[model samples]
Target: MRTGGKRTASVFLLLTVLLLLLFYCNLALGTRFFSPAKLFSLLSQGRGNDPAVSILFKIRLPRALMALFLGGALAVSGFLLQTYFANPIAGPFVLGVSSGARLAVALCMMLFMAQNRALSSFALVFAAFLGSLVSLGILLAVSQRVRQMAGLLVAGIMIGYICSAATDFLLSFAADSEIVSLHSWSQGSFSGMSLAQVRTAAVLIGISAFALLFLAKPLAAVQLGESYAESLGVNVRRMRSALIILASLLAATVTAFAGPVSFVGVASPFLIQSLLKSNKPLLVLPASFLGGAVFCLASDLIARTAFQPTELALSTVTSFFGAPIVLWLLVKRRGK
Candidate 1:
């Protein structure tokens, strides 16, 4: 067991270094590869009349940073949801939170577009948050009646389909130009993120991440069951409330910026737990966050370069990878 623990710690260290390298790779290697040294020089100095430098700053950096923050947020949200529900498969995407957020954001976008008003970034996030809460409310109500985990999951999926249908119906009535924009976003591409949006996300996600970490102990206690958690002096109700709000905010932020990414939330925690061979919350949370960052960064890289001129949506690449992991998990659980 000690040897296995050492190996997992080593893996975490390796992943951290790999994540840093991926950051640079995402910045420098694209359709046109910039030398690492050149990137350093560009950053060290300023973008003094160089169009490439502008592309580097105005495009790649923000996207990579978005992938980092939103990806980590999505995974942590999944961890919280899974912990709360005591189900391995429970997550923002699987529970319809992402789709709910997407529907809300889509409606907001259509309204803004119809009025010829530009939608602010924070407005999109707020809309998504409200949508996430609505979906969460429905899921919680369903949970009270659903006796089995399968029934709960089925209900969640139904909610997702309903939201997706609503989003599609709304888009059908939107202007052609606006539809084009909304369609790309709804499909989940991490392109076109700006520095200002990144700053906002960083600040918000940062505070939330810290709050989550602070609750790690309570979260772990809750995993055993509400009665057990309360016996240990953890306020089960408040803990659950925090979990729902934090998970919703995290999910909403991702949907707001990157659209509805599939499966990362459901997959990252499993992958991280497998690597660590432990379910301790303190260890799992950070490892899960890093795993998520790596997954999204790699997925984003493939999305941009895999099809050359035709960049795929971020979710396409993630779904290609994440879906299989989810399937494998289901099969493994069934076998167990």
Candidate 2:
């Protein structure tokens, strides 16, 4: 319709292509590489009892799907936080939501191991959600005290550090035998995703994402400020509460499965907004979700392939790229 709209449309098309390309690369390239032709052949043959087929079906496909859903959910969650706080830097990791979730999951895992009990998926999500809410509560309280956005951000980072320290403290008391497994989860990963886990993430993230979409209009109004949003008939208090719950739920889901993959939440929304050149929630939300899927899929690919036999943690790669973007944003904001 307009020049900006055409630009946004073109950007969306480019992101879609990039997402597909990254998805294929993640499935095809790993410790053992599979050519695109081979990947197609394996999949086309009804996935018979072949080892490569098993790897494709059981490992790569599930892992890729997990990245798409959880990564998108994390991004959408971050956008929700950013909208709620009117801060570009606000995200699950930056605000300590992921750290809190990680801490809770670690505690649950340690407790289960100590008692020789297995932790269920539902229990893991519940623990993570509880911890995320705890962190969000502290964040909101701190936000009230801080007049400047930077002050709030610093407080959020401090909260994250405290949660991380607590997690490390708990790990120190873990049994030596259990340390390896717990350590892996704490580092954040997309590995070992089963079909069941994928299905579960899909349902949780799908619902959360759609719910967010439903709130897009109100959220956009909220972004304009509480007074403006109220003038527009948006219930500011209820909207904020919903944002917190939905954002926390999505963050908890990611933390529960992948142990808090970093920076996707922060980076994706900003990147999409830049490309879209618009802040309209209807456009930004969907683009951010796709961009997030691409970001994590690419990061997961690097995590798996960069070190070859020993995989780098998913958060490691994300933070490497994400932290700089954040610094640049802070600098740009200051420039203004």
What do the candidate models score in CA lDDT, each in turn? Answer: 0.91, 0.90
RMSD (Å) of each candidate, 1 decimal: 1.2, 1.4
- Residue range 1-336, candidate 1, lDDT tens digits: 889779777978988997998898899988878898889988887668888788889999999999998889999999999988888899999999999999999999999888999998889999999999999999999999997998999999999999999999999998889988999899998898999999989987988888987899988888777889899999888888999999999999999999999999999999888888888888888888898989999899889987888899888889999999999999999999
Clashes of 1: 0
**Clash count, predicted structure 2:** 0
The model with the greatest TM-score is 1
Worst 10 contiguous positions by lDDT, candidate 2: 42-51
Model 2 misplacement above 4 A: none
Query: Which candidate comes out best when scored by lDDT?
Result: 1
Q: After superposition, how far is residue 62 of candidate 2 from its true place, in Å?
A: 1.3
